[model samples]
Target: MAVDPDKAVLQELARRNPGEPFVMLNLLRFAADGRASYEEYSRRAAAFLRQYGGELLYAGDGNEALVAEEGQAWDAVLLVRYPSREAFSRMVTDPGYREISRLRSRALAEAVLQPTTPWTRRAG
Candidate 1:
């Protein structure tokens, strides 16, 4: 039930190719009656996202998993792209953004924030 990133997580992210763009995959499981709070958090977070050169590529509620172990389905999924890992790290640590982050923490019982690197495609 990790609702927020810890120091080690942020440190690791900063240690990576800090200037490389990346997409973050968010898997969220809400607490009871948590959706409303999360919605508010999303609204407030948009400004910070924009300020940090982040974009919301996709967001959708989860449906039947089709293939997963029991209890594996999430309540929602979000894909957010950032210009660089450093930008993301900065955004999350900003004092202003930190104020509204409580809404996100309270809204989720569990969450997964995984950063992904795009694979280079070969020309045909």
Candidate 2:
């Protein structure tokens, strides 16, 4: 399970310009008594998000899964939308944001951070 994205992932993200906003889907598994830590991180991250033109779309604790594998249910889920990939990249690389991320790292047992690009169906 990856808690953070690596340089390779960053590089790949950098190469893509979908010409649309990017929203990250966070699937989280908390460590023992880790919600508090994640809350701290989220509190700290709120400022950075505003500074970088990003917003927390939704954040909620997960519950029953209507469909999925037995172990596939997440402890929490978050949707964060960024103005652009460059803005997101900048935020991730920011020294201040990195410090805030420490709390998030400590709070999570595992996480899947997937960036979603909005797209509309093309009809002919």
Instruction: List pairs with backbone clashes in candidate 2.
Output: none
**Residue pairs with backbone atoms closer than 3 Å in model 1 (clashes):** none
Residue 56, candidate 1: C-alpha displacement in angstroms: 0.2
Estimate, for each residue in 1-124, the C-alpha lDDT of model 2 and write its tens digit: 6798998898778679834578999999999999999999998999999998999999998999999998999999999999888888888899999988999999999999999977888997
Please give the range of 10 consecutive residues that has the lowest summed lDDT in model 2. Answer: 11-20
lDDT by residue for model 1 (30-121), tens: 99999999999999999999999999999999999999999999999999999999999999999999999999999999999999999899
State which candidate has the highest lDDT. Answer: 1
TM-score of each: 0.96, 0.93
Say what the RMSD of model 1 is. 1.1
lDDT of 1: 0.96
